[model samples]
Target: MATLRVGRSVARWRVWSTSASVVVTEPDTLAVAREVVDAELSAVDRACSRFRADAELALAERAGRPVTVSPLLAELVGAALAAAERSGGDVDPTLGNDLARLGYDRDIAEVRPDGPAVPPVRRVTSWQDVSLAGRTLTVPPGVRLDLGATAKALTADRCAELVNERLGTGVLVELGGDIATAGPGPAGGWLIHVRDRPADPPATVRVTAGTAMATSSTASRSWRRGGRLLHHVLDPRTGMPSSRVWRSVSVCADRCVIANTHSTAALVRGAGAVTPLARAGVAARLVDNQGQVHVLGGWPS
Candidate 1:
């Protein structure tokens, strides 16, 4: 876990595979925020984690047929399928096997940095292959579903809402740059630093109330296998990491899931993303592989 003092009363935790920054108007409410945040994250991972054997996601995948799921997994899968629909298969949820074959079968920390690149599976699966109705989840044999793209953002949105509603205080949560805020923010709203990668220099934005922001990158969490470089963001069409066009993309929308959907799709769309994002009525900042940054749809001044 990591902490930093922002202004005076902000307390943050860099856990759950990313950073969670929480700030309260009253410093005394800090402990309450932590407890709520931890519970929310734990619930999400336990329900959806691809690596956890007990997770409903794993159980559903291994069933090789339709199976009943918990309410939590159903909602999470619903969100993922919604994302896939919104992005037109650009951000499919059925690429879990592709991710595994690409050497991301476990948590990033546990993945061997020196391992050889995993070749893509010959089987081609689409998000349409998986069906969800009411509380039942069905996946044909050999289909692997992973929600790494939108799950964390959804978690951040829920955490912020829970903390704000429970404590009646302002809450700002940044789960690895999937940011969300609820209730009332501080005097100048919430200050956000948008970066191409975690360590890069930032472009700051101030958000108020219900806005959520997310960044998707082809940079970090990457490893080389057999002389080829690979990172997380996979193109559903290719079943492989997207072609190196943009280094990163960031977007802001009404909710964290929406923000993540746009950001991930923008990265996959590469240079062609600007037009579509503008049409979607969302603000975006994209940095290409050549280090040139492009801004569209009025992404903060």
Candidate 2:
């Protein structure tokens, strides 16, 4: 008898990034796949989201004093600190309080600009200020850990890994537009959409094998505050929203966690970091605020 191959059809389910559709030949049950995606997204929300007060990250943020933490939290903070170093403090994880001081304490949906307020209001700087010894991460007397960049990607990467290990099949995990995939996809590659803004057209990135692609853009996650447009991607060097360098940067690499780290760092560093990224052998595409597209590194021209 021929190999008993269970015929399967494609099914889509929405969760983190609009929706995800997968076609599997081995898995005959649609309900099982949907359940896997649902469970994975729920884990991401519980571990890394800033909106939920009951999230693990929220608990860590409110730890107040030096306290022992789980390996997952430690991994997120460590990756964030490393990114801060790599970006030369351009991607600090200790800027949560600073973001709140600038009127982004709530979701961007509720934000509205008042009028011209201050030109150069400094917020927080230096992830070096957050000290982690063993499992106890000691935040400097008044500092707070924001791991917004790192935690989201970390959750994405982990969720992808979990599905692959448990289900023994291919998986694609996405948070917003950031994505991580494991095993093999339908076409032997994972197809991703890279959008400059919410309204702009999406460009495709074909990823093969175990890979991660992350994009950081200032379009959807920003609002006008004090007569100024402000976004969440804070520059640790200036302690404010990045100004008119690049509108967005999308990176494809081995890990979503590291890809997010680099993409956010590159945005903060502006156009200056393009050469370094190219030299480091990373794929990146940048869209400037003026609508100019810059394809650097391994990104297709």
Candidate 3:
């Protein structure tokens, strides 16, 4: 149990073999945090995890051509498919094999020294390659599904709701940079650090009560391939890492899932994503590759 006392209103708990931090105002909320975080992580691991054979995604993959899927995997795939359609195919979950071909098959820690050299670019199999018939999901031969972007955000949202329901109090859940907060904070809102580049100093943002925040950046969780930096934020159109038009995009919406939906789509949208995001009433702070910043609709000007 990795624990840290961060502030008066927040205590950070590292979980899920990844970081899962919870924020709460009540002193007694830690118990709920413990239960909710574990359950959420377990749910994500079972659903979309590529590394676990018993995982729902793995079973779907091995079941051989168009099989009934577990509810969790079906839900995640359905969400990804919807996002792909809504974002004009900006975000695609069928790029798992493409990502692996690009040397992201293993965790960042185990990546070989020469692994960064990206092979020749490949074609995106397209989200349409995935066929969902009710509770059944089928991927075209050679297609793999990855839900890193949506799954993490969904987990954060799920855990927050779980804590709120179980503890009968508000909760905040942060999975890496993606965060979702609920209930009342000490102030009128919850304070969080926002950054474009992961290494850069953080700028602060206050999320009003019951709202959640998520940040998606091309700069974080990236590796160098063929002397070029390859990031996990892939463009569905090109089947390659985004060109880094935006270093990061942080969004505060009513929920973590929605914030991630906007932020991930925003990263893929490049410069053209701003107006739509703003018109949609998303509060967004975007940092470009050149270090320029733009604040969208929800932020104070």
Candidate 4:
């Protein structure tokens, strides 16, 4: 883990193949804040990791019948299902098998950059097929659950809220660019440098306390297989990687999960995303495949 002191103390580490950063307004609370983030991250990884064979999700998938799960997993799954509904199936959690067939069965870092041709697998089951009653979850016979889309953002939201509640200090938790904050912010506000790719122009925006931001990118978590470039954001309809109409989409909302849901959906929606995103009434910035930037719903220019 790396730590930086700039009025506040920030700790950075790697988890679940992505970077995690935690910042606290009160420097003295930094250690305790880091502890809270670490504990929560570990818990989330255990509950929702798609790559871990011993994770709760794996066990539930292997059972083939309804199985009781932890409240955390239930909440995670619930959020994912809600996202799928909100996006009209553009953001789906039941594409796990489709993703695997396209060469994303393991951690992104472990995925082979070049592999044999694998045809796109049609979705046999949609998010509607998965059932969650109380804590019991049921995955259909051939369906697999993938929580990658929403679980990380939910963890960020959870960690920030938990840190602020327990430590009584303003905290910002960023997991792979899905950011959430709570408590009182620093002077002015929390300044976030928003950019999807390293070469893209950056914009610094201030977010007040208790708000969240999430960025979904086709540029990241991508690989080449059989001469075709593939990314993680899949269209549930075709069970294939979405065409790169937009390289990335960033959105701001009151909650990280909501913001992430919209951003990921925008990628799947492609050029047609503007009208729907505009209707949703959230501030968003979209970077197209040609690097043209489009701002909507009062997103700063």
Question: Per-residue CA lDDT of candidate 4, range 1-301, in tens?
Answer: 1112354488877878888888899989999999998999889889978888899988899899999999999999999999999999899999888889899999999999988877865556899999999999999887788998999999999999999999999989999989998999988788788886788767788778887999999999998889999999999999889989998999999999999999999999988999999999999999887788889898843
Instruction: Report how far residue 169 has shifted in candidate 2, in Å.
Output: 1.3
Name the better of 2 and 3 by TM-score: 3
TM-score of model 3 (CA atoms): 0.90
Candidate number that wins on lDDT, 3 or 4: 4
Ranking 2 against 4 by lDDT, winner: 4
How many times do residue backbones clash in model 4?
Answer: 0
RMSD of 3: 2.9
Against the hidden reference, what TM-scores do the models get?
A: 0.94, 0.84, 0.90, 0.96
Mark the regions of model 4 whose C-alpha exceeds 4 Å error after superposition. Answer: 1-8
Model 2: per-residue Cα lDDT over 1-301, one tens digit each: 0011124544555554344444333365345655676776686567656567887767766776777766766777788888888777878888877777776665555645543453555554478878777677766666666777877777667766766766667766666666777766656465555775665545766667677878887765776656677888887766788765887888878998888888888878876868767876898888887776777666842
Instruction: Give per-residue CA lDDT, model 3, range 1-301, as digits (tens).
Output: 1112366545565554456677677767676576777877887787778666687887787776888877777777887888787677777888787778777777656655354466556584788878898888887776778888788888877788888777867677788778876666655566666764556545776566777777888876677777887888888777788777888888878877777888899998887889879777988888877687788785732
Candidate 3 off by > 4 Å: 1-9, 15-18, 122-124, 196-201
Output the lDDT of residue 179, model 3.
80
| Top lDDT model | 4
Over 99-202, each residue of candidate 1 has an lDDT whose tens digit, in order, gives 88888888887877766656665556888888999989998798878898989889889998999889888877778878887888777767777775655546
